[model samples]
Target: MSLIRKATILRPILYLLVVCSCYGDGGGRILVFPEDGSHWINMKVILQELHARGHDLTVLRSVESWYVPQNSPLYTSVTVNPAPSSEEEDLGPDFFSDLMQRSLALRKMFPLRRFLEQQKDTMAMLLTFHGGALRVISAILDDAVLVNQLRDSRFDLMLTDPAFSAGVLLAQYLHLPMVYNVRWINAGEAHMTIAPTPPSYVPMYNSQLSDRMDILQRTENFLRYVTIYVQERLVIVPIYADLLRRHFPPGADLVSMQRSADMWLMRVDFVLEFPRPTMPNVVYVGGFQCRPAGPLPDELEAFMQSSGEHGVVVMSLGTLVSALPKEVTEAVAKAFALLPQKVVWRFLGERPAFLGNNTLLMDWLPQNDLLGHPKTRAFVAHGGTNGLYEAVYHGVPVLGLPLIFDQFDNVLRLQVRGASRVLEAGTLTTENFLEAIEDVLSNPSYRDSMQKLSRLHRDTPLAPLDSATFWIEYVIRHGGASHLRTNAYDLPWYSYYSLDVVVLLLTPCVALLWVFIFVCSRLCCSRLRRKAKQD
Candidate 1:
C-alpha cells in the first residue's frame, strides 16, 4: 500500500481505539455495602449506571437473598456472597414486614397518649433486632478472607445505606470514605445528618401530617420528632455503637462518623415530598428507578388489555410486604371485583379465594412498566416510596393503603395534594377500599394533579440516574469532595440555628424594661412623700 493509503487505514483504527478506551474509563473501584435484598433494589439502578460508566463495582451481599429473585441480574451479579447462618435464616425475609406490622398494631390499638408510652417498648424491641442484624452483617463483612480481599482491593470509596450499621462498620474497617444512599424518606434522620428544618413546617416521618400544619398537627409533629430523636440517638445509635465496639476498635464514634458521610443520596424530591431546605452534600434522586416502559410480557399485556377503555389498576405493597393478612387480602379482592377496571394484584403466597374474574394475581411484576402503560389509570398501593414515585412518574392517580414507616406520611401527602385517598389499615373496610378506588378513578382532578406533578418530576436537567452517577464520580475524582459538606455538621444544634442569638437579644430588652418600671415606681413614691410633707 502507498504511504497515504496506509495512513488512512491507521486513522480509522486509531479513532476506533480512542472511542473504545473513553467509553467508561473513569477507572474507579467503588464498593457497595450490601443490604437486605429489597432495599438493595433502590440502589441497583444507579449502581448499574455507575458500573456501565467503567467504575469497578463490587457488592458484599447476603448469600441467600430470599427477597431477591434467583433470576435477578442485580442479585446474581453480586461479587461477594455472605452466607446466612441458621440463626440469620430464622430471622426470615419478612423481618421488615414483622417490624412494620408491630408499628401498625401500635398505631391501631392505642390512643396517642397510650401509643407514645407503648412506643418505647416497640422501639426497644426494634433496637434489639437491629443490633442482632448488625452483628450478623458485621460477621459477614468482617470475615477474615473478606477483610483481606477488601484491604488489598484498593477501593476508593464505600457507598451504602446506613439503615443498618454494618455498612458503616465495613467502611471503618477498610478505612474508605463513606457515602450514604438512604431509601426511606425519614425527615428526622435527614435533620440529624444534614438539614435542620423546624418541625412547625417539616412534618416528622410517619406523622401523617402536612408540612403546613395546624396547631394540633404541629404539636403532634414536634412530639413525634422528640420521640424519634430520642429513640435514634439514645437507643438505636447506642446499640449500633456497642455492636461496632465488639468487632472494631474503640474511638470509632459511629454516630458522628455516620453524620459525617461525604454525601447522602436521598430517595426523595420536593415534587412528591414537601419542600425543605437541604445541605449541599444531600442530593435528591427521587424517581431514579423510573424509566421508559419496555415491552411487557405476553400474559401481563393481555391482562392489562382486558380492561380496554376503563383502563387497569396496579396494586402492589412492594417487596417488603410479601402478603397481607387474610382479611385484608379478601377485602382487596372484593373491592376489585366491583370495579370496571381490571386489577393486577401482586400476591406472593396462595391466591385469595375471593379473587374476582376481572383480577389477576401474580407473584411478581414489572411494576414500573405497568404504571407507565397508557392503560394504567390508578394504583392501589401500600404507599411504599418506590411504588408511589413510579405512580407519580406515570401520572397515575392512587388509592393508598398505607401500612407502616413513611407509608402513612407518603399517602397523607398524596391525599393533601389531591392525588390520592388513604384507607388507613386501622380503619380499612371493603366498602371504604372500593370507594377509594372509585373516587380516584371517577375524579378527573386526581389524574390532573398527578399529571402536573409528573411533569415536574420528569423535567429535571439531568435524568435522576445520570445526576446520581455524576455526583458519585465527582466524589471519587475529588477524594470525597468534603468541601461540599456544610459547617452545620460541626456546629451544635443551638448554635447552628442561632437560638442563642435570639435568647441574647431578648434578654437585654427584658432587663431594660424591668429597670425602667422599677425607676418609675420609685419616682412616684418620692413624689407622694413630698406632697405629704407639704400638707
Candidate 2:
C-alpha cells in the first residue's frame, strides 16, 4: 500500500517537471552561434525552454560555457579559437573585448588575416586562449550534422557578435538560417538594418551622422558593400559579371553563400523600445533574462544586507570590457573609496593598491540579482545593452560610465531618453564621479523617470523571445524563406545599394556640363566663321 502511494506521488512530480520543461522548439536542426562575450549567457533561458519542449538544439558557445548549461538542457558547442599568440604584436583582454569593433567582420570581402589581429588585449585571452583546444572542439561540433534521425540539415540559425559574421556566412553557404541575437550593442550593420532615420526610436542613424562617418563607419560600410557584390560574385566580373553566368554556374561563387537573413533574434523586450516599427520580419525576444540565474550566491546576498540601509552600488563593465589600463583602475578605485554607499565592482584583475574596505573588487558577480536586490540603489555600469535592459527592468537609475565604442552611444541614448546618466571615462575626477552617483541616487526625479521608462519599456504587446520564436518557426514552416524577399536584385547598384543620391547628384550635373560644352563649341565655331569672312 505504501509502495502504491509512492508510485502515484512520483508519477505526478515527473509529469509536472515534463510540463514545465516542454519548451517546444522542435527537432528541426537549428545551429546557433552567439559569439558576443559572456552575453551568450542570456540564451540559457531560451534554450532550456526549447529543450523542455523537446527541440533538438546545439550551441556554439565559449570554451567556458560548461558551467552555464552543465546538465539540464543538453546542447553542443563550437568555439572559434582566439588568435594565435606572439610576443611582437599582442593586445590583451581589452582588445579582444573590443575586437568586434577593431576586426573587420569575419564575412568581410577581405581575408581573415587582413582584419583579424594577432592577439587581443584580454586578460581572459591570455589565461584561456588555447587554439588547439578550440580547434579540437570545433572539429567535434562540425559533425553535428550526422548525429541524427534529424538527417541532412534543414536550416541553421546563427546569432552572434558582428565579429562572428564570417562564421555566419559560412553556415549560410551550408543553407542555414543566419540570425544575430542582440546580445549587446547590435553591430553597426545590424543597427543599419533598423536604421533610425525619423520614425524609429533608436535614432543613431541619420543623414547628419552619415555625413560624419569618421572614416571608421564608412570603412565598415564599404567592406560590407564589397562583400555582397564583388566578393560574392568573384567568379563573375566585367563581361563575366553577367547575370547569365548564374545560370551557367558549376563551381560559381555560390551566391547562395551570400546570406539573406530572414530576421533578427532581437533579445530585447519591445516594451523597452519606444516608437517601435511595424515590420513583418523583425521580432523581439529580449528579457528572456534569467533562466540561467540559478540562485544568488550567499556572500553577495550577505554583502548587500550587511551594508544596512545605505544601499550598495554595483560596478561592472560587463565581461569583455574589463581590460583597461591601471590608471583607469586607479581612478575607479579612488572613486569607489569616496562613495558613501558600499561599492562592489566586478573587476577581473588583482586588488588595486588604491582600493579600500568601502570597495569590493572581484572577478565576477551575480549581475542581475544584484540589480534586482532591494539594497541596490544605483548601477555604475558600462551602459551595455544587456545592462541597459536589466537596469530598466528593475527600475534602477544608472550612472553610465562608458569608456569605448558603442558604450558611448548606448549611454548617450540613455541620457537623451532620460533613462540614464553618462560620464566620460577619461576625465573622471573622484569628486565628479561621486557627484554623478549622488545626483542619480538622491534625485527622486531620476528614479521617477527610470520608473516611468521602465513601465514604458514593458508596455510591449508581445515578449521579445516569443516574437523571436514566431519568426524562427515561421521560416522552418515556410521553406527557404521566400516571403521576406525584396526586389533588391531588380534595382540598379545606385538604387539597390541605395546610392541613388550619388546617381541623382551626378546625372543633372553631367547633363548641365554637356549643355555648357556644346554651346561653347558652337559659339567658338561662329566667331571663327566671322573672322574668315572679314579676311
Which candidate leads the pack in lDDT?
1
Q: Tens-digit lDDT track for model 2 on 1-535?
A: 6999999779867855753454344545567654534555666656655555555676654444433442344566544433354543344554554554332232232433533332122222322332223332344334445323223544445444333233343454355656556533212334344333222122331111222355655554455444323321342222222322433345443233322566656655544443434344555665656322334678777777888878999888886665445666787788778777888888876667888788877787878878878888889888677887788777888998765445655665566567678776655666787788889888887778778877776666555555555566556545446566455543565775668887788999999999999999999999999999999
**lDDT by residue (tens digit), candidate 1, 1-535:** 8999999789867865754554444568888875665577778777777766677777766555554343444322344454344453355767766766666677666567645745665475556556555655666655678678778988889888777677776787777877888753222446555677688899876677788889988888888778877776777666666556766677767666667778888888788788877888888888888898887999889878878899998889887767777777788898889889898888888777888899988888899999999999999898888888889988999888877666887888788888988887655678998888898999999999999989999997567776677778777777786788777657777987799999999999999999999999999999999999999
Q: Relative to the unseen true structure, what is the Cα RMSD of model 2?
A: 10.6
The alpha-carbon RMSD values of the candidates against the true structure, listed in the order shown, are 6.9, 10.6
lDDT of 1: 0.76
Error of 2 at 369 (Å): 0.9
Evaluate model 2: give its lDDT: 0.56
